[model samples]
Target: MRIGLYPGTFDPVTHGHIDIIRRACTLVDRLVIGVAINRDKGPMFSLEERLAMVEAECRYLSEATGTEIVAHPFENLLIDCARDVGAQMIVRGLRAVADFEYEFQMVGMNRTLDPEIETVFLMADAQHQAIASKLVKEIARLGGDISHFVTPTVARSLMDKLGRG
Candidate 1:
């Protein structure tokens, strides 16, 4: 059984993120969506909240794709998480040239950390290439509708965090 790790901050799982998850599901037997805790980049939602949001979003993904998808909160190194989960591949979504550049470096670093684990990059669907968690948060904070970008649960969570709900 091939296990793939999809690690991200997932401040709130967006439709774009779900798209990638759905796409990755086709290649791997199981996909573990890792909700990484980043201290450097202060998040609008807490780690637990982010994990909860991802969990809720993934339920819809699993139902839609009929794939085994699990979300786990990881405070440790990604390499350690991959190893712990026995993941053979790290799945990433590339949205643009900038994302490619950044992910290329990360792929190299992940390879250095664990040579057995390979990083796989998937291009984001053209419609979702411009959607990002940061942008969704900013727009939602400014009273703009983000219903199109994220799931209803995520939209509500973002609104609650921004004190708009």
Candidate 2:
């Protein structure tokens, strides 16, 4: 089976993330959503919370697309996570040139760690290109509507998490 790893903090999974997950499903038989435990980033959601959100958001996509989508929490190196999941490819979503610059460096580092595991970059759909988890949370925290950037379920979760509801 062709397995691919898509790693991210996913503090709160946004539409942009769903877009990438949907697109990545087309390329791999099994897409592993690597929920990174980056405590340094001080994510709004805990690892378990993020994992639940990713699993919930991806459930329909997996069933509809006929792809096996699973969330795996990882605190180690990204390449190690890929290997642990038996992934042959690492999927990344590029929103803009700024994202590319950072991803480019990551790809280089990942390649050095494991040249056999290739990195694939999927450009976010235009509508979701501007949606980011951090920005979404910020908007929600400031009492702005984030319905456009996240699913209703996620928006509610954010509101509940931030005590806005």
Candidate 3:
């Protein structure tokens, strides 16, 4: 069975993220969603909060898509997380040219670290092309509606974190 890994900070798990996760699942037998604990970014949500939101959001995916989807929290090395999950390919989503440039560099470094693993890029669905976690958080913090960007649980979590709920 082919396994794939989708690694991201997923600070609050945006709809765009769920879009990528669903798209990635169609290509692999199992897809592991790695929530990176990159503390350097000073994430608005804690690791536990991020993981919980991802878990809550993804719980129905396996049954809905007939593709096993699991969310796990990881730290530091992404290649290590991929290896641990037995993933043969790292799945990435490309929203714009900027995303491509950044991901291209990361994919190259990941390939250099593990020659056997490959990377696959998918274009984000047009409807969600502009949704990003950072922007969602900013909107929520500034009293703007972000109900359209993330899941209900994530929306509430973001509001709670920003002291708006």
Candidate 4:
């Protein structure tokens, strides 16, 4: 089976992420959503919460697309995480030129680490290209509507996280 790893912090899974996940299903039989445990980012949600959100969001997508979607938590190098999941490809979502520049550098580093693993970039749909988790959180924290960016469940979670719910 062709397995792909898509790694991200996913502090709160946004619509942009769902768009990528839905599109990524076409490329691989199994898509592993790697929820990064990066303490450096100071995530608004806990690893468990993030995992639950990712898993919940992916369940419907998996059923709809007939693809196996699983959420895995990882604190190690992304390349190592891909190896652990036995993934032959790393799927990344690109929003803009800025995202491409960073992802390009990451692809190069990952290739050096494991020349056999390929990285695939999927451009975010136009509707979601501007939606980012960080911006979603900020908007929620400031008492702005985030319904357009995240699912209702995630929006509620963000509100609760910010003590606004």
lDDT of 4 by residue, 1-165 (tens): 999999999989999999999999999999999999999999999999999999998999999999999999999999999999999999999999999999999999999999999999999999999998889888888888899999999988888888878
The TM-score obtained by model 4 is: 0.98
Q: Per-residue CA lDDT of candidate 1, range 52-153, in tens? A: 887777887787777788988888988899999989999999999999999888888888988999988999999999999999989998899898899888
C-alpha root-mean-square deviation, each candidate: 1.2, 0.6, 1.1, 0.6
**Candidate 4: stretches off by over 4 Å:** none
Report the candidate with higher lDDT, 1 versus 4.
4
Give a tens-digit lDDT track for model 2, residues 52-134: 99999999999999999999999999999999999999999999999999999999999999999999999999999898888
Worst 10 residues of 3 by lDDT: 156-165
Off by over 4 Å in 1: none
Tens-digit lDDT track of model 3 for 77-106: 989999999999999888999999999899
Give each model's whole-structure lDDT: 0.88, 0.94, 0.88, 0.95
Candidate 1, residue 25: lDDT: 89
What's each prediction's TM-score?
A: 0.94, 0.98, 0.95, 0.98
